[model samples]
Target: MVPVTRITIQDVAREAGVSVATVDRVLNRRAGVRSDTVKRVEAAADKLAYQPDRLAARLARARDYRFCFVLPTGTNTFMQSLHSEVEATAARLTAERIRISVRLVDVFDGLALAEELERLGEDFDGVAVVALDHPAVREAINGLADAGVKVVTLVSDAPGSKRVHYVGIDNTAAGRTAAMLLGRFVGPRKGKVGLIAGSLALRDHVERQFGFEQVMAREFPQLEVLPVREGRDDFEKVETVTAALLAETPDLVGIYNVGAGNRGIVAALEATERSGEVIFLAHDLTPFTRKHLVRGTIDAIVNQDPGHQARSAARVLLSACEDTPIVPDQERIRIDVFLRDNIP
Candidate 1:
């Protein structure tokens, strides 16, 4: 975990090898501060990567930037990790005069999510939402932008909106990668491939499905893609759906779960005594997925760094609030492909 980061005068003073008073005087442009001391203090602050907002804290009304993370309410292990990372990032940034809060919403429900986004309006300086690509949700995000609030889409993107930035992996690329891996893994086997997701309403899932089909149609025509099923990333729902899929299609040779609930799929496979018979590819390398990968129950896992996404979302929102230039490379989230040999 990242340590609590507070760039106060004391930190600058220590870095500058000067007393607190000297550093404070230098920062405040007060008299009695020597030129060399001012130079040292400025250098130390720069080296510490301190934000100008720290100086703004001296005013009668200090600037406290508040950011909101609108995440989904689910038991998905990946979502759980993302929620924890958000909280950790919030704690690490609290000392820097940043206020971050996470709000749980049914991201699968377009209207409900839109209502929540609309309710958040101008209350927060910036908002990072796990946005669904729905007209209502996009309208709500634009509403926030029109109200002078910065909006960023997190995890899943709501395109064609007034959002200033997006923080997550390239879903289309991830999907294509999954398709190639699964296709090659089940090489020469002519059978049906089942696609599962939390919700098709999510732009990420839809893009993944699209990309997967594109590759399958071009390179892996031997495999037939079944109509996708939505499990809401629920274990029970996924288990029931998987059982149905497996029962209905005895020739189910491959499955690509673009969302969570890998455990349910694995359990269903185990119960049906088809654990090692079918090729399974999943998203997010959580403990369960990691174990399954190592045990050869799961062929591959596509993952995005939850911690990096959380930190990037915060940094992007802060930059937007300050009108500062954002470093694209610093905020770009990488998609990781983990197999059994490279479980780490």
Candidate 2:
């Protein structure tokens, strides 16, 4: 048996310069205390080396805790997959006394996402956000963090902020992997390859484009990668852009899609009667993309499993609440490559 230190609420109250009731409110996270007072109480507790018995507090409080998830409302297959996976995990977490509320906002509209993040301040204990690299969104995340809300960035991340943690694969590495696959698939073909990205405004897309260009320039000098065309993650837009590229560059022997737009790419290739003739590489393993992979519409797919992303995000949030250490390796997501030979 280990020795324990006995500390009482009155002791904490005296040290914190507040009443016993204020200490109670801070410990239990009850209403009526100002944020500054709460911070003082927390600081006092830490100074005194105070640690609350979490199990006892949980049993006594028995208050339902809520987690908010904010994501983009887009038809892009990757976004849809992320939304579905989060919903599934939220449902499972409900059984463990956690309530998850999901909110969807227009991805293209940065103001809408920022507004949504701001609105979550009063309603949730923690938040999981798929963020864009915008100042308004970053400010909103900082506001939430200042309010003692644990923020976890999913898929896309906001760096240099008070966000508790992030749960996603290294997107730059994923991009490099995609480049490697495409370069190998091209196999010494000396021609300009077209690149399609969702939106350069997004950090993930920008990072991917950077990595792709870096690898292509370093390893395959003969393979000139064309300027990236923004598809906006829309099927019709992707098709239109791809068609224009095909028309302009007749020797476009290879293509790489660093974002969701596989459907449009497939349609464009088929309509142009060059589906199998062009070596195409894309991201994500949606049902349609999988089928296209087998049929040779897409030569390869760089997949990041949505299931893994959701689980990792949840585990990180839970660990934050419990004040526990995260297993980095377990949470380190993988960049999976899918080809015709390995469809699963």
Q: Which residue pairs collide, candidate 2? A: none
Expressed as tens digits, the lDDT of each residue in 60-97 for candidate 2 is 65675678888777679888888888889988876666
How does residue 30 of candidate 1 score in lDDT?
83
TM-score of 2: 0.83
lDDT per residue as tens, model 1, 85-149: 99999999877778899899989889999999998876799999999989999999999999999
| lDDT, residue 159, candidate 2 | 89
lDDT of each: 0.90, 0.85
**Which pairs of residues clash in candidate 1, taking residues 3 or more apart in a chain or in different chains?**
none
Clashes of 1: 0
Error of 1 at 51 (Å): 9.9
Which portions of model 2 miss their true places by more than 4 Å? 1-60
State residue 30's C-alpha deviation in candidate 1, in Å: 24
Question: Which candidate achieves the best lDDT against the true structure?
Answer: 1
Q: What is the lDDT of residue 294 in candidate 1?
A: 92
